[model samples]
Target chain A: MPSADEIFAGLMQGAREEAAELWEEAKEFSINTCWSLASQLVLVGQAFVAGEFTKAEVTKYLETIRLQFIATLAAALMKVEGLAERIVNAALTAVRDAINGALGFKLIV
Target chain B: MLRAIVVLLVVLVVSGCSSFQLGERYDKSLDDDLSAFQIEAVTFVASMRLNSGTPAGAFTSDAAKAFYPKASGTLSNIVVKAGLLSSRQCPINGIANSIGLPTIKIGGETIAADTPKTVVTGNCAVVTLLALQNVLADLEASHRDHQKIGPIRGQLAIDDINKAVATTLSGLRAKDL
Candidate 1:
């Protein structure tokens, strides 16, 4: 067994690699989230079975194939939660802008 | 197989934990620069307003000065620290890895070969925003004596909060996720 330091070091590397790989996962996650229609859903189901997913999953699925399934599902979970921050920022900005404009003070400028 | 799964589950749980504070614990250099900037900006405009001798009336006509540091020594400290963490990618379950209580320890009670942990920066921006708010609130509370608030100074603090929040928002991007 790798020492705990070795293990942690590996995880960090995996995360870095995964962060870069997030783009493909993001596209895949987006497709899954959209679930356009029956045809699209079928394709995603296929992809899920095939083990193609976000970088976070790469770390997760590494444990096992079942873990991989778990990883992909969590990636989808990540997508919803991930996009949420974008929405929050947009909302905050909207609120901030409105207040700043009203107050005639540039809060962020 | 059962043992592997159980052990792997433990590792995964630990890895999942780091997601919050994947970044460095705290950037001391950034703190120093930020505090210094705050003191300078606060002192200057504040004293200027006092000396300007503007009449004590609502909506004074003095042109307000804006105080915003064009750069953050903070980014340098954060990036440097993040770079270091980036090198240590292997994940291990540690206590600090939890939300805001950053204790970087890894337990090796049970597991397969070496297991690695992913990193997270946590809600640091939120923490900073809250800290700033508390400081401002406390200042307001303490200064009830004279009730002195320079329009410029007040505006600067609000601007500071907005800027900090914006920086924080950028980090929430999926790439950072």
Candidate 2:
């Protein structure tokens, strides 16, 4: 039978891999959102330079876009943070379960 | 090995089971309402794009001006509905200890330290809806000022609204897990 230390090390390794994957997902989401928002802004800048929008209209539109991006970014970050918390809790639970199973009793509670 | 297990349990007990959180129970009604709104919003923007150069679809035209009040009213209803859901549903609690409460800031204003998680988890839907409202208003203003929304700007607005709604819906769905 595998010893408790060895079982724990293995479970923790799995947990670390899981956490890293989640982190990578979060990073990618933020990057993509930034890219999308920047692209829209570039379009606005181009239109402004082309004399399509007056200065006041451009300024107002930019402010509105800023607010829109802020809310979207905030919600995205919240989703990431919430998922990370859940992953941590799950990892701990897995370790506890593995330890208990190895000892043939409720060893960790 | 036994000693290590004991130490791990101690750490777990100290940390608490699910005290660290920023999520609430999944509300299906919230999901339905937002999804419905998304269709309505995108469809409206698409219509505006199609009719950009027509006098009948002009922002200042009587027909176009009539849609604003109805759209704004629907959004206001959504904001209220989401607020009720967030306030009513509580996140599951495994252990009653909070380790790190992250301070959150949006648009340069810091949310209150004590309620950051709850606000983010609960009020995030409301916040996003409110932001969408602003976007709608901006669209209205742009249409009025410019006399019509060009196809490019119309598509951009649709894309923006779609993304915002998708992110919030996904977040709300995640809370179920």
Highest lDDT among the candidates is held by which one?
2
List, for all models, the DockQ compared with the true complex: 0.02, 0.13
TM-score quality measure for candidate 2: 0.61
| Runs in model 1 lying further than 4 Å from the true structure | A1-109, B1-21, B53-177
In candidate 2, stretches whose alpha carbon ends up further than 4 angstroms from where it belongs are A1-27, A49-52, A84-109, B1-23, B61-63, B87-122
RMSD (CA, Å), candidate 2 to true, equals 13.9
lDDT of 1 by residue, B10-100 (tens): 4433343212233323344444545554555456346534643344311232322122222233334433443442233212113213422
- lDDT string for model 2 (B1-177, tens) is 977855765477445553335544457887888888889878877887788789866887775777788778877887787676555322311111132332222234333333222222335566555457767877887788888777767766787778777766776776665
Per TM-score, the best of the predicted structures is 2
| lDDT: worst 10-residue window of model 1 chain A | A61-70
- Candidate 2 displacement at residue B156 in angstroms: 2.4
For model 1, the interface Cα RMSD in angstroms equals 23.8
